[model samples]
Target: MTQLNNVGIIKKANIYFNGKVTSRTVLFPDGTKKTLGIMLPGEYEFSTDLKEEMEIISGKLEYKLSGHDWVTIDGSGIFYVPANESFQLKVHTVADYCCSYLNE
Candidate 1:
């Protein structure tokens, strides 16, 4: 990933998932958005309307893309999810991550 500097006009957003998950959205200057947040230890299923690249910033998580087997990812690791698809994540520890939405 390329370095992003001069991110102008940040807006904070909170996303809730039935009290199980919460993520803070960070808006950048060039219309790119990233969510920096933590995921509690549990199993979660998520559907996305846009393509996303999820990077593990701290801790670890095991995730499975649709029709795929689960794989573990650590800090600095990334996984991609295509648009209109769903994925599952099983977290054993409190995982910190950044989800970047990819604009087409």
Candidate 2:
């Protein structure tokens, strides 16, 4: 296993949805790879390339999975977005969030 100590702020990332989404690749302690993201106020559509995600921070959000019902989230919460599922997120206000991806 490997470790990162006192790492600084992110320097590289990809932006989507007119800057509503930002993605960055990071290395984990177990020597694995992960992708992290930050979503701001806007409407967005995404599909996961991995099996699941673990939310690190959360706030109010509106979402809908492909062909599924829409839902809203409030406060700090953690949830999973299944792999290969297309989903959309609509932010009512400014929000800060992060999530860890599985299998890249």
Candidate 3:
């Protein structure tokens, strides 16, 4: 997770919730993609097209998947979001994260 080698990054950011959330798309050679982003304190709901592995680099937040209870991720943690579904987040502090999109 320290370095991303041989990858392409999109120049524009994916901005959401009035810029409270922002991320840049990183494209890998194997046709996989990931997003590195920062989240400011806010509540947000997101829909996913591909399965996602979200790794929190720092800060605190709570996430809720469909049919599941809210789970807290403080300091650093990782969570998975299934494809073609939605999830919610309540960010308590500024958080840095990297999300890897899975083809499977």
Residue pair clashes in candidate 2: none
lDDT of 2 by residue, 29-67 (tens): 665555567777778777887766646355678878777
C-alpha TM-score for every candidate: 0.83, 0.73, 0.96
Note the Cα lDDT for every prediction shown.
0.81, 0.68, 0.96
Question: Which of candidates 1 and 3 reaches a greater lDDT?
Answer: 3
Candidate 2 vs candidate 3, TM-score winner = 3
Better of 2 and 3 by lDDT: 3
* Residue pairs with clashing backbones, model 1: none
Report the alpha-carbon TM-score of model 3 versus the true structure.
Answer: 0.96
Model 3 deviation from native, Cα RMSD in Å:
1.0
lDDT of 1 by residue, 1-104 (tens): 65556665345546566655777777687788888778888899999989999988777789999999999976658889999999999888888788999976
What lDDT does candidate 2 reach at residue 16? 82
Sort by lDDT, top down from the best: 3, 1, 2
The order of the candidates by TM-score, greatest first, is 3, 1, 2
Superior by lDDT: candidate 1 or candidate 2: 1
**Weakest lDDT window of 10 consecutive positions for candidate 2:** 1-10
Off by over 4 Å in 1: 1-5, 8-13
